[model samples]
Target: MSVSLPSALIGPLLVFVLLDGFIQGSVVSLLPVIRDTLHTGTGPAMWITATQFLSAAVSVPVFGRLGDLHGHRRILRVALGTVTVGCLLCALAPTLGVFLAGRVLLGPLSATLPLSVGLVRDRLDTAASRRGVSLLVAALILGATAGTATAGPLASVAGGGRTVLWCLAVLAAVGLVLALTPRISETVRLASGRMDWTGAVLLGLGLTLLLGSAAQGAAHGWHSPPVLAGLLLAPVALGLWVRSSLRSSEPLVDVRAMAGRAIAPAFACGFAAGVVVLGGQGVTVAFLDAVPEEAGYGFGLPQWQIGLWIAVPALISFLTAGASAAVGRRLGYRAMLTAGFLLMAAGFGVEIVGYAVMATWYAGHLLAGVGIGLAVSGLPTVITEGSPRDRAASATAVYYNLKTAGGSIAGAAAAALFSGLLTRSTHQPSLAAYLLLWGACGVLALVSAALIRLTPRT
Candidate 1:
């Protein structure tokens, strides 16, 4: 398990992950544009993102199974191709509905991270694999920063959001080429059994219902029939999905394995990170973008400048990710996870001060960037610790799926907050919403730190 890979062998894969991260970050940059272009309200704007998370939540696991059943390299190609097509749809769409449909297509590409993790494990020796994974993880995190940073400037210079989408399409196409560049031999893990189609549908529908309720509740009164029904149906649907998973010959998630010590905590951390960090991303931008100059409350920066601001955390995280594995080696994953949460908490606390000093803002974001880098680096290693080599992709899928779902839930909550508070501030989430978000994220980061401590050492 310790073969060193040629840079040529690894470079394309790293570039691909960076592209994925960039695509991920760029989507946030595009959210405000997409919302404005579609003429949707603030509450509805979040659906553009929430829907992606909900859809990706279900699709990631399914792709993981396909990767296991067939091959990681083959499935990755399918993911890259699907993203290229999805980018095409988004770039050309004439209306909000079409754009959302395009967002659904983009969900399948989420499997790339887990799939690539599997590829690294299969193709490299143990020591080399560890280095590759660390590099890949850093690239994924760094690309997001680089993309977010670059996109704001791109938007400022490119003249429009649609052009940004076109840029994304070209990026996806490049990723497709890189995926094709590697003559990697496909590694098939699971050699038998059919897919859990029933499980996938139930899980997807259930999550959609629950997340939909949070979103719809903001637009319609919480007492509205559709919202009410969604609230009532979500748990029942999810419960059934769980039951089906437990009884199925080939469950989408292995209940026993998931319940195991190391894996369970990793999933928990992923979910927490989703709500507190990933989910907060959109709101963070809104806080900077929506606050009017007259309001005298926010930085009053332009959209692209706000993007550069947002990218600060990502840049710091990117720089810190290189050291994450080494830090974990020196201080144990438990310590790394704990430290990450604390840094995030500190960052949130710094933001909550809402001081006029722009430097204060950058400092908070930079702290968070480093914290997030550490957690992202450690969480996956923990999840995959005792997993079978063949099952690595699927196992990682479980973590990613929950993380996506957590982000969806947090976004729904933010949308609801925006709906109620928007009357006070027409452009952005109200000041109240911003305070609540940072406060919640801070508390949750503290909680996550505690939980990581309880994860039994492998």
Candidate 2:
């Protein structure tokens, strides 16, 4: 079927995608500044990042299922509006606790990307849908890159860290406006399933505990009572969620839907990629911050400069993601994933060498950017291709949730590792921490490669 959307609709949708990235990227980009301003250690700062991911991890699947039940466009509008409020709260927050409250509110709103993707699928014909998906994905990557890269400059322009939060609030408001534009249409109005409140609550609690425990374990010691309790509760909650889901007349997560052969592997690849890429990025940022200026290990760049440096890689990733869509059509999804993982592995290896020499680190970051772009872009396609027609949105949501969770795991792990190294050494630990992180990322990439290879060709 040939579908013709008004030209006006495209700009608003595109802006929404970009804004989604801007909010997420801005939050992460603020990590260094927040750490400095709050007088909090790396562990707490890491939790700031982890909280956003954990919240999103808990919300995405639930939101996706809801979107499918109600309407994708309606959900998008509500989410964007809620995000605007959250961003405003963040801007107004006077303390770290208030800021964290804002982040928790914003977390569920992060499902905007998947919801947007589903909207595009619902609105467009096959050809236009494919192109729309590609563009939306590219926008998402660019938004993240731009947020990370430009946040520093913007903060500098605004005159302080607080100004950056104001800037994010403004961007979020713009997104909300775009979301309200009348040109957008409600699509995929599925039969209303009973809202599985019990299952959702159980799953959310389980994931939050599991992720929270993973994040805090590094800081408090794994054996700490709180950490142990969270860990202990995670499995029990998960088992309960599973059991409830299996028995429910209308389940929340739909476990059986996830059992499809192709969908399972696609999610596995995405989750694994999320862990390595996010972890690597966390380590790189931390290394930049902790390294001493006098020691050849540090750039000693200000937050703005570091933020700008991040942009270079982000731009490269955006460009590569846009390119990968076309390439995937020709080479197929498996080939693209394999190639992406290899490039990512190569990037990590280069980063390790650069740290060893303590020279020209930007080149390594650029390589890593390209790898992340390529790998991340291919993930949606893999999930979409494998999913059942009715469950496509939920399946994609599952992938995104896993990806967010993986990133949290990686960030927490990096924090723990770096903290451990610092405790042991009086001198700069940049080289040691980075080397270990790079090696870990390389191993992750290799595992992804192997997984891709084992999967049957589409």
Candidate 3:
């Protein structure tokens, strides 16, 4: 059966995907600049990044479930609208508090990715669905890469942080319009499921506390009362939420889904990928900022140039991810994942080597980007294939939430490493941090490969 979509539909969908990714990438990539402008310390800067993830972690599950109950199209439009508002708040934010608020609002908007995926699945026939999914994933990679690459240039051209926010706002508006125009069918509708308000609250608070503690602990010292309290409270809250979920007839997250063999490994791989992608991104930006002009180590590129540099990998990743989707179709999902991990591992290895030879840094970034593109492209397929039909959206949400949380953890860890390693005599760390981080990426890829091998072929 042929599934035909209006020519207009494709452009809108693509725009929506691009804008969503662009916002996320831009925010993370521009953090260094934001920190400089705001005069915020490393701890606070980490919070800016961590808060976005924390918000998404809490909101994705809730919104995804709600999306299932209501309509995905409705939720997507609302989410995109929220993104516009958030971008505006960010642009106008006079203080750090206001900016954090904007980030908090942007959390629910992360639903853009899954909602976009669901739209394609619901609206398109099998063949079109495959193509749509491929394009969707490509847009995601592109947005992320573009956001990183363009942020510096955009900020520079726009005249400051405020200008970047305005640009995001305009893009978000375009996404909102696209989301509103087409009425995509909502395929998955649960017959009866009460919103687990208590579960939602508990989960949100628990994640915030836990993630906040992790991000802040290194900066403030883990022993600090605020950090300790957050850490201690998180597990307790999580335990309570789990108990609540198990008892509730309609749990917010179906814990059983998480326990499935196929699903569990998918989540693990997504989490690992998040750590590497975000950690590598954070390190790249920081490395650019810290490298000295006098030493051969630094490019001494302006913010705009640096942004472009950051973007190059993302662009490469976006293109390669599309290629990966084709490979997945030909090679099977499991093979696709394994191949992606291997590529990523190779990329990280290249980075490790390049860091030693400063001249080769650009090549290392390109390799890393290719690896990220490949690995990320396969994750959605893995999650979908692994999930039970009944709980697919929730399962997808869980995988995503874990990935975002893992990325936040990586950002924090990297920040701590960079700060601790700062020395008067030596401008850059002994390259040990970069080596360890890259090594960790390689290990994660290998582990993902093993897991992919262990899962029974579909």
Q: Write model 1 residue lDDT over 400-436, tens digit each, in one string.
A: 8777768767876877777666545445456777778
- The segments of candidate 1 whose C-alpha lies over 4 angstroms from its true place after superposition are 1-9, 32-47, 188-192, 279-281, 289-296, 353-357, 418-433
- Give per-residue CA lDDT, model 3, range 1-458, as digits (tens): 33455445456667777887888878876787788777787667777877787888888888777766666678787888887888888888877888999998898767776766665555555456555666778887787777767787777777777778788888888778767774444555442566888989999889889888887877788789999899899999999999998999888887776667766777788898888887866677656755564433454566556666766777788787777656766777778778777877877777777764555867767776776777777777667656544454566677788887788778778767766665556656545676777788788878887887766564
Q: Could you estimate the TM-score for every candidate?
A: 0.88, 0.89, 0.89
Best of the candidates, lDDT: 1
Candidate 2 residue-wise lDDT, 1-458, digit = tens: 33344556456777887887877777776787877776678766776877777778777877877777787777787777877888888788777788788888787667876777677666666556555666677888888777777776676677767888887888888777767777777775463567788998998999899888987887789889999999999999999999999999788877875665666666777878778878887666556655464444655666656666666787888888877767776787688788888888888888877764435566777777877877887777667656544455666788887887787788778877776665334554546777898889888888888787655585
Q: State which candidate, 2 or 3, has the greater lDDT.
A: 2
Clashing pairs in 1: 1-125, 1-126, 2-125, 2-126, 3-125
Q: Lowest lDDT 10-mer window, candidate 2?
A: 1-10
Candidate 3, overall lDDT? 0.74
**CA lDDT of each prediction against the hidden true structure:** 0.77, 0.75, 0.74
Query: Global lDDT for candidate 2?
Result: 0.75
lDDT of 1 at 207: 77
